[model samples]
Target: MEKKIVISDEQLQFLSKYLNKKFPNLSPQVKIELMDHLICGFEVKGGDDFYQYLSNEENFIKGFINNEVKNVKKTYGKQTWRQFFSFFTSRELLPITILTLFIIFLISKSISNKNAWLIFVVSTHLIMIVSAIFGMINKKPLRKLDEVKYLGAEIWLPFLMVTLADNLGFKNWLIQNEFIFTGYWFFTFIYGVSAYIVLRRQKKIILTKYKALLN
Candidate 1:
């Protein structure tokens, strides 16, 4: 026969406060799921009365409290990552785009100086290529469903970097009046289009994962 476990008002209040503080926007469904887990935990502790269990096995109670704290910490960490993903998929690209523009500006200013512009453009391209190669080769597997969005970002970011670098290189070459590179405009157009597509795809994937977790 399975043991029945009851939680005290104090314990429930503590959990509620902790959950609310840690997850202010936690959905009611998720709250119920967490409560169910807590009930199972209480049952597994194995005692006729909750207070008796706590008093009789001080070490167990201590361990349980420690575990709960660790769980809360982990939850916060996950939450932080989810928030970061939101920013990364949307606003974080802005800095990279700006950096690419700055590089273009510098290259354009140094256009008359072929040697300097060539060195800068080549160095930037090489770095971007190496980064893309490494990112593709050393990509980690997604451990959680929520991490799928991150994985998708990883998959697309290299392509974005490459496109940005290619565009910048073409711009630099054009400024140098070398061979009249029109590919830069094409690459720039592609970069913007791809960025929008990737952002939307990532947003949908993340939101789906978030909804699944709620259930």
Candidate 2:
């Protein structure tokens, strides 16, 4: 019969410190997963040469972290676009979408000056930039997975919104053109709404994942 190896609290702390020292910027979520992997790998080696094993795997772990972070960002990138388009396909969101477009139409008709409309669109983009800054600063102690997923999605989103807005605002001629300016307002409004929906969904998922962590 084989004896089961259990890691001691001291050993776990040492492992954690080692991880922190090696990867200072590791996301809490990935850190936790890596911890589990280390423990399992150590146990598989008859609980011997833990330090040697860790040292050997340092580069491999770094590569793993890089890949994981990239994959997470890529996934959220796809999800944001998917969520944006979902508004049109979703039966529940259909009414809200129609109402939103009607309101935009009303606003467009009401604003006679092209300059005013350009200002309005640029202001909306500025608001998104502010929101992105908030997301980065608002740190909460969440579960490992929640911290990873929430930060991953939230951090990536603000950059996208800010970049999109900045690029559009840069094209002074686009906003000045009669036909493009009209479509630009609708695009900005819908894009902002989609971003809001995705952020809200992320909050909901994080809250649901670890209700006790926040309390």
> What is candidate 1's lDDT per residue for 152-197, written digit by digit as tens?
2422433454456457665444545532332342233234334344
TM-score of each: 0.29, 0.66
What is the overall TM-score of model 1 with all chains considered together? 0.29
Q: How accurate is candidate 2 locally (lDDT)?
A: 0.64
Tell me how candidate 1 scores on lDDT.
0.47
Clashes of each: 0, 0
Global Cα RMSD, each model:
14.2, 4.7
Clashing pairs in 2: none
Clashing pairs in 1: none
